[model samples]
Target: MGEKVLSVIPARKGSKGIPRKNVREFGDRPLVGHAIETCRESELIDTVAVTTDSQEIAQIGRRFDADVVIDRPKQLAADEVPLAPVIEHAFAEVDGEFDYVLCHQPTVPLIRPVSVDSGIRAGIQQTADSVVFVVDSTHHYWKQTDDGFEAVSSDRENRQLMEPIYGEIGVFLSHRDLVTRGKRIGGSIEFHTVDHWEGIDIDTYADWQTAESHRSRKQLVYRVTGNDQNGTGHIYRGITLADHLFEHDIVFAVEPNDNIAIDMLEGSNYDYQVFDDNASFVNFIEETSPFVVVNDILDTTADYVTALRAAGSRVVNFEDLGDGTEHADAVINALYEHSNPPENHYYGFKYFCLRGEFRYATQKSEISSVDRIMISFGGIDENNLTARTLQALAELDDQLYVDVVLGLGYADPEQLDPIVEALPDNLQVEINQQVQSMAQRMEQADLLITSNGRTLYEAGSLNLPVLSIAQNAREQKHPYAFVSRGVLSLGQAAYVSEEMIRTAVTDYITDETRRETMRTALADHDIANGIERIKQIVFDETHENR
Candidate 1:
């Protein structure tokens, strides 16, 4: 005992912008087929009809399972005739009596069935004569006066803070009586707001291309963690990847108590969700059913990946060596080196995803002497290597300039303060905490002292020689820095003494030939295009499944 709704889709034969656009292939179906399928799938719509002058469009409508295909008259299909008369002609031709009539345009094929149902429900609930779909316009409006062009509004505000202006989306739901009166919109009208993509009206070739580009957009979820234990490399990488995927819906999923990741993401405009536990996260993923789930946490368990796959999400893991990597559709371990990796695994420095800053940074030039040295120990500096490296540099009798860039999660600031206070006059040390641009800092330095992590790849991009100290056993497993000879590895920090670091730095500075060789090796490697490579992998996987 509900109101009967009839959906009438008008797809005329003649098109001014694109010839025969009504039957043209869109994503996977013809242009008119999208509207027919959307209307047929709508729960509130009782009957779906397509009124078109072209026999080809009528056949496509029938193929898409449209309930009826009304033959529009030649006179009513004229270019100048308004849509109200055509809707009236279709309403009269349809046999069934409907309480509501929905006029859907085939040009706007991106409209979803849920939006259609919502418009109908709003019309019925509000008891309005018609419901018209609209989208909020963000563009600044202008008017041409006698003198010159002037702003439409006197109050000028930021685009984001501006008051909302609505534009019609060419789709409307009207009462049956209004359709008989040759009027689709009249009297008490209810406005239904839809997303910008759903409101795309294809009139020009550019509009068609825009709609096609939006058709491939999908929901992407990044399951990442950032803390003192694992450091914030994963979180930074996730943010960089999310920046490139602006067309899709991106969400960052973190652990319940991971305030470090939350605080970091607050600076970003992306949406994030914090889950209580593994079960809750999995349940949320299942409900969302995202197109892709990217895991940036160091390692993942088999059970966790299985749950994600069961949720119908394409799984991609970064720098993961756990058993779950076996089940992942794609595994990218740019930090670690493998002689032979699985077909799905992309390993080595070639897959390294550098930040945008490094991609455009100027490569370091050869120096006659090492004047400025940079010391950084990744984000967390769990082993307090920054202090150890600084202590090593202080013992040197040579007068040198040193810059210590501290990370956001550096916990041993107290330990670092004492080392800087007692530094000899020969070593002019500057302590920089949470520096904005790592690339700019690296460009100013002749040698870089850092942990064996993503930072090495970043330095390599600039052809800057590095003296590396492995923070842990897992970091020692990464052999690209050592194999490439770009970094003089001092082994693990626990085993490496102050004297050992001093010797390594002293040898690198004195042996100009070795430094030049290292720089050349780094320059020969191609790591700048890793982001584009990873983007291709993600889009290929999502597109194949779609």
Candidate 2:
């Protein structure tokens, strides 16, 4: 059999930095329990022992299946006393004549069993007297000279070019003889680098909070409603913000719907719930008690926002045009322009939240010709604009390819299928539904026919000239789609005749200078950084009280 190895975990009862730090609850167990449990689970170590002065810590160590619990002497239990004597006492209590000994501190609960096994393997393979875990310093080291502070090394060089300085994280492995000599790391030391997060040794309240930030499963709850009438813009906006907050747990609380909104939620790896009534929604909110509640519905009422605020949630609303806008902590209305906005009201083109694909997208090479025409009304084109636009595109005798991009809510096949089947051979029209790469489709197209909503901004981001038609009066007020913004607003969908669309398309397509001007205006406006700005606002509001 190979030589025996002993693991000694030094956990004293009294702690100065954090009161009752050793026996205090951390996560689900006491601080010392993590160390004891880790040692007990190690395969390389033959025995696991803990040295503690407090009887409570000793009991916890035993309950965690520590092989031996040594009652440390009063002299070794002081706040200022070093851990050398504690490890020596634990080594002496063990009867085994081990070849190597590992000194682990209970304070560094993040130390894993795999690290212990690796350290032991290095000690045995290299035949080294000691092994210790260390982490590379992140900050530039400074030394205090007689005159003032000076750089320890490379004073003028960049931090990346400077030699790395390693800091010990209180985990050491040594030969049995070194333990008796009061030395955890002796001659022939082998250094083992640990993960930066794992090397964190919690000593203060801030340290514990940092550890919790990495370990805690905090969630961000999103509440939005969408369907054919409400449109899926809210659903898209909710998920976009949720994607930015991937560091935390994300949950979507949408109102009951069987539309493409459900498909969108199912596509993503996020938890979601379909609430039937306000009572159930309120109950769910009270139960989860999320870090933040994001409402992307058209307008949130004062009573609803008040109730959410009363539930101890920082409410963030999107496109909030109701009395609730005053009650909300933050509101982003990118499409709809609001005058005399409130303190947290973020409107205009600058606040437009595009998908990740279009944020940093480059404009098309040139507005060469109007050979390819694309039509994308919002996800749920409730106005049946696709069928109408197709009818107008067929009238054009030019051999133009029409790409009809359908959303999840485009379920009116009885009307759409006949339009496609009756289209002339010269006018090549292909229907693509639920397109994943809508940005690429927009980039390739010469003219874009879209509704006044989120897709209008997406088209603007790619510098694709838009022929916008309002789905309803609500969309008609969206100022960004007006002629002033280089978008040819074709009035409301119900009132827009096929001849009107043909006239607008012919006007933009025939005039190359007008198309160029539209593209130039769009290229000047950079809206990619809006998401970051909104994220900062959310972060500030959520963490301000904390």
TM-scores for all candidates: the values are 0.96, 0.64
For model 1, residues 1-546, the per-residue Cα lDDT tens digits are 389998899998899889999899999999999989888889999999999998999999889999998989899889999999999999999998799999999888998999888888999999999999998887689999999999986787888888788899879999998999999999999999999999998998999999998998898889889876677788888888888886787999999667778878998867899887779989998998999889887788999999999999999999899999989888988998777788888888877888989999999777568889999886778788888888887778877889888877787577777788898998998887778899999999999999899999999999999989899898998887678878888898789999999998898879889989888888888889888788767655432110
lDDT of 1 at 261: 83
Per-residue lDDT over 1-546 for candidate 2, one digit per residue giving the tens place of the 0 to 100 score: 396888888887678889889888889999888888888888898999988888998899889999998988999889788877778888889887888888888767776788878878987899889898888885677889999998777565676877788888878888878888987777898998887767878889998887666665456677777787676777777778778875577788877663556777888766788888667877777777776788877777898888787887778888878898888888878886766767787778777777887866667657868899998886668878988899887777778888888876677656677888888888887787767788888877998998988888888888888999999888898889873466888889889999999888888878999999888888877677677677766654432210
lDDT of each: 0.87, 0.80
Model 1 stretches astray by more than 4 angstroms: 145-148, 541-546
- Top lDDT model: 1
Instruction: Identify the runs in model 2 with alpha carbons over 4 angstroms from their true place.
Output: 1-218, 360-362, 541-546
